[model samples]
Target: MSDRVALVWDDAFEAYDFGPQHPLKPIRVVLTVALVRACGLDALPNVSAVIPRSATRAELETIHDPAYIDAVERISREVADPYGNYGWGIGTGDDPAFAGMHDASARVAGASITAADAVWSNTVEHAFNPAGGLHHAMADHASGFCIYNDPAIAIRWLLDHGAARVAYIDVDVHHGDGVQAAFYVDPRVLTVSLHESGHFLFPGTGFPDEVGRGGAEGTKVNVSLPPYTYDDAYRAAFERVVPPLVEAFKPDVLVTQLGCDTHATDPLAHFALTTKTYRYLARALHDLAHSTAGGKWVATGGGGYQIYAVVPRAWTIYFAELAGGSTPTELPAEWVERARAEGARELPDSFDDHGVILPRGRREEVDERAAAAAQETVARVFPYFGLR
Candidate 1:
């Protein structure tokens, strides 16, 4: 297996931009690459920034409806979703019709598919597509700033290529509803999502009772963590849930959605994770990939609203861990200045985020909620996986 980790990127990826007012700003990605360069990850022998091809319509159709594809194409040309009857979740402010929307979304999916192909073909043991992981996207609709579900498409492609089993783990603050919905009844793909409880989050699904259907029971894991869940609570829940289920599933490949919005500084979401805690999560996932799937892992980027202070550092830690390099404690001063100039509201002196303080009388409720959610996942799904 090649030692290098494929880093999927292209100059046109910034075309996935929604607009300046959108919370899922493309500048976060730009700042991530900038920090990667400042830390010399792009130049690392173990990291290769591979250019990606835009996915063809056929590839996209593997996970999206043909009519939806046609709608996206039409919107790309018209620069607006004129037909509101498709019911594909277009024509909304969240998924505004932008110029080249189809091409850009396809490009993100293509990068993820290419990364999956590389890992499966043994061209690379691991790959990271920082531009991919549009997980909230349904098969036929755009939602949560995602036009197409890249992680789901990549997982489906793996199954179509004769892979017996694939395990998808999502760490986004929001539920990985799209990916879970994609493979809810398919035993070949196992999707595990750990996010802030849908009771308090957007899209408002991912309850424990919504496990996989039919033969895929216990295959779909959702850890609905409580609000204000700190690193210790989050880590405890994660360790209690993911590792055992992955071990039981014994997947041929591992795909992870590493969304950084769980950080306290993120403008969106309520998880209280620091960069130091994020490092542990990254390392654990990296190790899980090796231990569970013969070192085959495809990592994708997802929701993170803190473009300046949080995302750059969180993903820098992820990349550093994935590429077998030490994390840079402090960002370069020049890069910090440049990041601020480029609209990073608050850049960090170090990679670590300041810890979030839980207000008085909040700890018991938070811990109880966390404990219940974790127990719900373990209780509902572990027996099906034969771990109980």
Candidate 2:
């Protein structure tokens, strides 16, 4: 197998637009890829750009209901859903009906699935799909600006192909409720998420008690952090949950939802992480993939609304690390100028926003709260894996 990583990209992925005003903008992915090129990630010897094929109906049916799939297609074709009562979570405010919604969403899912295929087939040790990672779409409904649950479908693909232990780590601000629900009772898939507390976040439901059911206990781990948690606390919380669980599970393949909305500048949620924090997390996950899963890692992009300021910068560095390259202290000047010429807001001069997070105090309190959440998760979950 090659040490190269697959880079899944396509221009059509921009069609996943909810609208001009929706927080989940596709331009973020575009800017990310641009920065990847600007920083010479695309020219790396170990990185391969791949144009993915859209997933088929049968492929999607593995996780989505056929009727719901049909509803997505219908809404994509018609201006309005012919069956308004379908209740498939389409045509709503968050996920409104749009042209080519199903095709675009399935394409994103396919890009992710293709990355998974490469890693599983040993064609590549690692892969990335910056347009994928719609973690909030449920079995029969779309939520949180997501259409099809691509990461869940890819994990299902892995399970069907004889991988006994598949581990998923979601670092998005919102709970990865859709992916968790998909494999909550399946012992073969371990889904771990670190997010803002459900009490304070949207689509909120990733608590310590959701540690899978029956045979799958300990397979679902959640570290719900406080709203204002900064880089050190966030990293500490992530380490407290993810490393131990993944080491214990010893998965066949590790899939991650790399959502960058945890930054303090992000509009949707309240996390004080900077670009430096994103780099640390990505490098840690890369090391864990090699240490735990023999380097079989498939990562995808998720929720990041700070398109100009946060998403592009964070993900560009992340892609560089995943491609086995080093990130620069300062962003390429050409990309910053391009962003400015395009009228981007808060065009960062360097990868680090250099923002201070803890001037308001309460670091100890936040750390204690996060530590308690991790302990509760271990108390409820670790015994299933014969730990603690």
Candidate 3:
């Protein structure tokens, strides 16, 4: 297997924009790439960028409904309200239709598939499609600003290409309900998500009891955390659940969705994760990819709203780590200026804006709450994996 890693990217991915007001701005991806390049990560020998084509209907239909695909295409062409039987999650508040919605969403999906294909085919040891990870889209409908379930499509691609076991780990603040639902009954795909509890999140689903169904029982793992979870709490929750389960699954490929929206500065989420903690999580996941998946890993971007301050820095560090480069503590002034020119407010000078390090010092009550919650998750599901 090749030791190089491919970073799937193209400027055309910015066309995935919903609108100016939408929180899921495509500029975050742009800024992330820029930040990585500014930090000299693009020069790394292991990290090569690949442009992706739009996913064909056949490729998309592997995980999405054909009618839904048609609806997205038809709605993308219409100038007026084309709200017929089109399951166009279009015309809705979260997923407003754009002219090139199909092209953009399909390109993102294709990017994810290309990453997975690269890793699985031994073209690269690891791959990242930071523009992908629209994990909220279901087979039939779009939800939570996601139009195509890129991770699910990529997983399906892996399965079709002879992958025996693929483990999907989602660290987005919201549950990865779409990906889980897509493979709920398939034992070959193990979906593990650690997110804010469903009670306070959108597309509210990933409960402890919502483990995989039928033959896939015990394959679905979720650690639903309380609202005020900070760095240490987030790390503790992940440590308590993810490592043991992934070790047990012994996947042939590891797919991960790293959404920076869990940061406290994000406009949409309640989690308090700092960039330091996110870097630690990325490193941990990367190590796990080597340990459990033959170093075959595919990473993708998910929901992150703090475009200026959080998203760029968080994902830059992630890509750096993936490329085996050091995470720079300081942001390039030129990159910050470019981001401002692109309508983003100036970001902080350093990646560590919060001052608190990994295993943050939280209030005792919050720490206790997070610890108790982690214990509850392990108590509920660890035995299913025989991790006792």
Where is model 1 more than 4 Å wrong at Cα? Answer: 80-87
State the number of backbone clashes in model 2: 0
CA lDDT, every model vs. true structure: 0.85, 0.86, 0.85
Highest lDDT against the true fold, candidate: 2
Model 1 clashing residue pairs (backbone): none
Candidate 3 backbone collisions, by pair: none
- Mind giving the per-residue lDDT tens digits that candidate 1 earns over 275-316? 767889888998888899999999999989887888878888
Candidate 3 lDDT, tens digit per residue, 1-388? 2258888999999899888888888888998999888998888877787877778889999988899988888788873642333455666778877788889899999999999988998988889999988999989988888888999999999999999999999999999999999999999998988888889888788877878889998888878887878887778878888888899999999999999888987888788778768878978999999999989999999989998888988888888778888766677878978998999755787866654433444546567877777777677767877876
Candidate 1 matches the true fold with a TM-score of: 0.96
Q: How close is candidate 3 to the true structure, as a TM-score?
A: 0.95
Candidate 1 versus truth, CA RMSD in Å, comes to: 1.8
* lDDT of prediction 1: 0.85
Which 10 consecutive residues of model 1 have the lowest summed lDDT? 79-88
Sorted by TM-score, highest first, which candidate order results? 2, 1, 3
Candidate 2: residue 246 lDDT (0-100):
95
Show where candidate 2 strays beyond 4 Å. 80-86
Going through the candidates in the order shown, the clash numbers are: 0, 0, 0
